[model samples]
Target chain A: MKLETRRVTKRYGDFLALDGASFQTGKDARVVALLGPSGGGKSTLLRVLGGLLLPESGEVVVNDQPLPQEPNEALKTLRKNGFVFQGYNLFPHLSALQNIVLPLCVVHGFSEPEAKERALELLKRLGLEEHFHKRPAELSGGQQQRAAIARALAPKPDLLLLDEPTSALDPVMTGEVLDVIRELAEGGQQIVLATHEISFARKVADWVVFLAKGRVEESCAAEQFFEQPNSALAREYLDGLSRYR
Target chain B: MNHPPTRRLLWSFALMAAVSLGLYITFAAVHYSWNWSSVWGYRSQFIWGWFTTLGISLGAMVVSIMVGFALMIGRRSTCMPLHLLSTGIVEVLRGSPLLVQLLLGYYIVATALHVGDPLVVGTVLLGCFEGAYLAEIFRGAVESIGASQREAARAVGFDTAQTYRYVIIPQAVRRALPGTTGQMVSLIKDSSLLSVIGIEELVQKVRIMNSSSYTALEGYLPLAVAYLVVTIPLSWYARKLERRFAYET
Candidate 1:
């Protein structure tokens, strides 16, 4: 599968969140990290790719079909994309198992038993089999992040979108979650993540896109970008981010 | 589990009883009848009237829920006019008194529309008035569910209708139950005001009995008991509903 954008732009009342931004992804992919400062439209770009927001101009084509003009149709295309939100937005009322099963049940028309069976498989793989009956409040930060990943993976989506998936976890917990993500990428899932984890991106990403002022300042192979970035903005971002590490 | 406050509670209860007896004696000396037999004789009419009141209130509540649902959807619709129109209608109903609305629906609307049925007029008044309050409850409930749930439903390929019916609405209804029940009880009490338009509800029946027998205390006291009979069970059921669909937050 291939996902690409052509001059995709989104503006929110005088604020240009994304300005003619473009990128592409193909199957059998490694991780792609969108590195940017806050309010630089990284989240906005993720939303555009996930079909959650419509561009004021330009277009997005997923697997070669231009996204439909109608909001509902575009949203249908979004079903194939998986998103992991920052803060791990798990349903508070639902048990861990219920949270994981929801996307599958909604998308695939899976029966209750069948959905649970699939949820249990993902839970077991994520080392959360024991936490299945617990609510999100009962889980630790690491556990909630894992559950969020389990939910994102449950539908077997073609494109995975993650927004700061490990922000809440400690270093040890972050490493644990990243390992699960790396394994998914190795298994051939195309993943796009917006994160502040520069070192993790250096280790796992194949493509690195540095964004500044709602436009792509630099896009390069991860090794090349980190080793010798072409843009002055990319250099400044790397230097500023390195201090926190 | 501790019964240590028993003495204090009893003293309060005794004090309340004395105040009540003093008031009753003062009123009785002013020729309020102690006519127990009159209450017993007209008991069936009172019972029938009480049932009519329940019927009207429940009918109005059902209608209110339907109108409320429509207004809820309208408020969320894409058309700006529909949204504004419903919002204005809700405001008009909520801002005005139910008694005033009852009179208008019965007198002005009924006359202008040339409808003779008091029942129709009363029901329309009760439903439209109560529906405004309920619309806010329903809207608040729908909004209370997290935005992520709607996004999740959409991402899973459910259409807008399915998103509401299968995912958003059930969760919203669960959250909205307590407020909905409270609105319903308020509707029941407000049904009494319809008696002003000669609707022959429980309060109306008590007024007629008191006028005929001149046993104001015996007649109206039983009506208070009757209203309590309906409201108490309803209040209890509302509490049970709150517990059953408890939101921890």
Candidate 2:
């Protein structure tokens, strides 16, 4: 999951979410952690990578090819990549199985039987097999988030971009989601995650990109960035978080 | 939470008694001569008119919903001309009075198109009038769905059409149910306005009966009850739908 962004800029009204932000990840880095405080550019950057938001300006090169300027073309290029949002935006009208099956059949062009088969397999893998027939409102928060993860993974995406996936969960629910994410990361699934869970990032992230105020404060291997300080911003950020524990 | 079935039944009976008492007092207060025999003589004519009103209202509802859905799609469409055209049509229809629309529509527009049947023209015009209002109701329902739902669909690689189809419209349709039914009720009441075109709906028949018998309450009172017969069940059904959808929420 190699990525190189050149002076990417995105704005929301009067606020700049990405202010000439140039970010890069090392080659073959499967688990890249985008760590930032709330109101920073982490979610926006993840959204841009997921092709859900087109940049206001600048270039995003993924795997040596530039991202497409045309909106449909861009989504086409990254169709293999999945995204999990802060809120588990499952289709409330659909049961867990249907939520996953809909995308498989409608978007991925899977036949109904094949889509159901794939959806059931994914639900079982996510420990939600017993709750497949339940709508999102019927499931607990942790279970719904897991269902959302299964929906994302059903497409067999090469890259999974998660934006604050645990931001809306309780501590226990967050742990449940993180453990599943860890298992996926360990299983060699490529993931680019923007999160606030420092310890989890330390455990699983191969590459680290610390952002604050819409700019990259630190970009390096996770090990060296944690052990030895690269910049004052990174050191302060890390120190403040460690002080909490 | 719901009241126990027995409690609900008791409350309904009590409320019905109160309404019936109020009606009894109101009618007793009026000095119009009691003419139950004359009202009975016109029962067959009134029944035919009631059926006519029922058919017209139901047909108009069907046409209105179709027009409403089409306008909603057009207003949200990517094509510039379609969006503008739908917006313009909705504004024009909703801004004018229904009475004027029936008059002008039948006299000029229907005549221009050589659509001479007053009943058909009136029903269609009533539908288009209510359709403009229904279009906005449908639009509000669609917008009530959060933006994240669409993004989630896209993340799964659902295209624009697929997003609306598999994810959006299903939920919107449910949310639209209550408001849609409310519009239907309004349309049913508004069908009385079609009396000006001599369609012989319930109100038109009652008006003629009143003039002939020189009695107001005899014909009009039963007409009101006849309307309640159609509309009360519809209101009850709408609430049922709202409850069923509420479970999802």
Candidate 3:
């Protein structure tokens, strides 16, 4: 799907989270990684794109349909996309299977048997068949994140938005979750993820947008942006990040 | 199973038995013209009174929970008028004493509305009183759930109502259970306060027996035991529910 934003600005009181941020993705770029500093507009832009957060001003259009300002209408539009939060946010009271089955049956209007079949399939695909009966509290961090991904993908959403999918995990757990995401990228799912892992972005992201202080510093192909960044801010940010790696 | 605190357990049992024996000896020595048979003769009246108390308590409990649910929704609503109205009601009901509210319900409301049934008036007034407190419990329970849970529900395509039905309320109810159970025990005890307004509950029946038989100890002790029978089990059940719903994260 073609996604574009025009001068989108979002503010929380005095702090501007996204200030006149504008960019467009080529139709071929299926996995777009939003690489930025912590307080930058990467998450804000991803939320705006997924219709999770309404921008204070300007436009976010996915396939030419402008995101609505009204909550009900916006929710209707957001139903077309899946969002995986940084915290995983799986239902603690629900088993892994029910987490997927509930959305499929309740929101998407699937029959009980049909929803169960779909949930079982996704759990099996995500290598969580043994954990189908476990609640989120019983699962490890990696298993919970995979269950969250399974819940998001159960409805077959057109677009997926992931906000720092691995920020809460350890290094080994991070690799496990990232591998699932990499597989989804290979499967041609349109995803926009806010991430600090530069190497993982280089491996999977087709397009990269580097943002800092609520503005896009650079937007280019992943190879081009990493190899020869156009702006000084992008170069400095990459340099600072590389030291930590 | 491992050591079992046997000495502590035996000490507690011995102490309880000694206390019971001392209390029984004191009772035997009182000699206040004890007339147990007079109180015992009015067994049917006491039973009817017990049934009335149970009925009112159960009825008021149901109404309070329903009203509490509505008040909770209204309090959390974005609409200013709804929020203000619910807040005002909760404050008014919770701010005043139940006795005054019962008096007002019987004297002003019952007379003004020309309602003759004292039991109905007492039940409704008591319900409103309990509802305000239950509303706070509901609010706290709902707020205790993290905001991310709601966001996750929304991301999964649930609308506001569906989110509450399938996700938010289910978890909130489990969290609220222990608190609600405590309130219910209090409600049963509070139902005795309805006696002043002329509802023939357990305490009122005890008062009648005291006046007729002139035996206060014989009349009041059984009343306290009856309340214990109701409340102790309720508290035990609340503890059970707390353990049952405790999700080990």
Candidate 4:
């Protein structure tokens, strides 16, 4: 997946969330991680990439095509991408299997049997087959997040955009979710994620984009960016993250 | 919270005993002697009236829910005229007295429109009165759903109607159950007001018996019990529905 943003600017009242943010994924980078501190515009940029949020101004180009301004026309782009939110945001009323099947059958117009087969496949792949009939309230944080990921993946979207997918989990559960993401990355799935899991990003991310104060500070291959961050802001950001470790 | 069945039964017996004692004391305190002979003559009337009340209440309940849903949709519509019109009508129905609406509907509007059946007009007017309140309840339930739910639906490519039908409404209906149950009980009791428009319901039958028997208490007591008979079962059904819709927690 070729993901690119050009001069994207977004504001929420007085807070500038994304200010002229621009970056392009390497043609072969299967997993691109947006690395930044809290409220550093990483999530906003990821949302724009996922077609979940439209920037107030500027272009979000994915695979060399910019998203249309009007929402109706942009549905094509939105449909091609799947998003996993920070909170996991699974429908509380639906079972784990249903969480995946409903959108496939309802929105994408898949037959029930076909959607069910697809949902069951993903659940088994995510190691959630036993929890197929359980509602979100009955599942652990990691299980719920995995179910949400399955829901996003069921439609076979070209790009998967995840926003802090493990933010609500414990260290143990975070590892559980991260392992699944790593597997997806290794399987050649295209993913753009905004995440705080620094070491995990270093391990799985093919490309890295460092953001701070609502602007991109650096963008490069993951290993180089993690080992020798060029920008002073990027260096300090990495230094601050390493303090606790 | 986990009382043993024997203990629960004991508590139930105690409550019944208490209520029975209160009733006994009240009857003893009254000056007039009890006379079942006169009231017994109207057994068939009571039976007829009881069933009539049930039919009217069920009819009105259906109307109220349909009208309420339509109004809720209208109020939530993006079209300016529809939103304003639904808002204005909801306000009017909620603000004014039900008796006034029934009178106007039966005496004026129904007459002018050649809607001669007072029963139909009364049921509709009474339903509209409750429908306004129900519309607000439905709206509140839909609004109480977290924004994230809508976002989740949208992220999966749901359009406006599909979102409501597949995601929003199923959850909203669960949240709205308790409020709707209360409204239904109120609707059953409120159906007695339909007697004013010559519906010949339970309350109307009781009024007729009281006019001759001159025993208001005797006439009204049975009416109250009949209403309770309808509502107790209704409340039980609501609880069952609540359990069915409740998310596992």
Best candidate, TM-score-wise?
4
Question: lDDT tens digits, residues A207-241, model 4?
Answer: 99999888888889899999898999888988998
Query: Model 4: which docking level applies?
Result: medium
Clashes by residue pair, model 3: none
Q: Candidate 1 residues A147-202, lDDT tens each?
A: 98898888888788888888878988898888988888778888888988998888
Q: For residues B28-83, could you state the per-residue lDDT of candidate 4 as single tens digits?
A: 89866777778888889988999988888888899999999999989998999999
TM-score-superior candidate, 1 or 4 = 4
Q: What is the interface RMSD of candidate 3, in Å?
A: 1.1
User: How do the candidates rank by TM-score, highest first?
Assistant: 4, 2, 3, 1
- Residue ranges of candidate 2 with Cα displaced over 4 Å: B29-32, B77-84
Tell how far residue A145 is off in model 4, in angstroms: 1.0
Model 4 TM-score? Answer: 0.96
- Tell me the whole-model lDDT of each prediction, alpha carbons only: 0.83, 0.89, 0.90, 0.90
Error of 4 at A216 (Å): 2.3
Off by over 4 Å in 1: A1-3, A24-28, A62-65, B1-33, B107-117
Clashing pairs in 4: none
Error of 1 at B116 (Å): 5.0
Candidate 4 lDDT score at position A68: 85
Please give each candidate's TM-score: 0.88, 0.95, 0.95, 0.96
The positional error of residue B210 in candidate 1, measured at the CA in angstroms, is 0.9
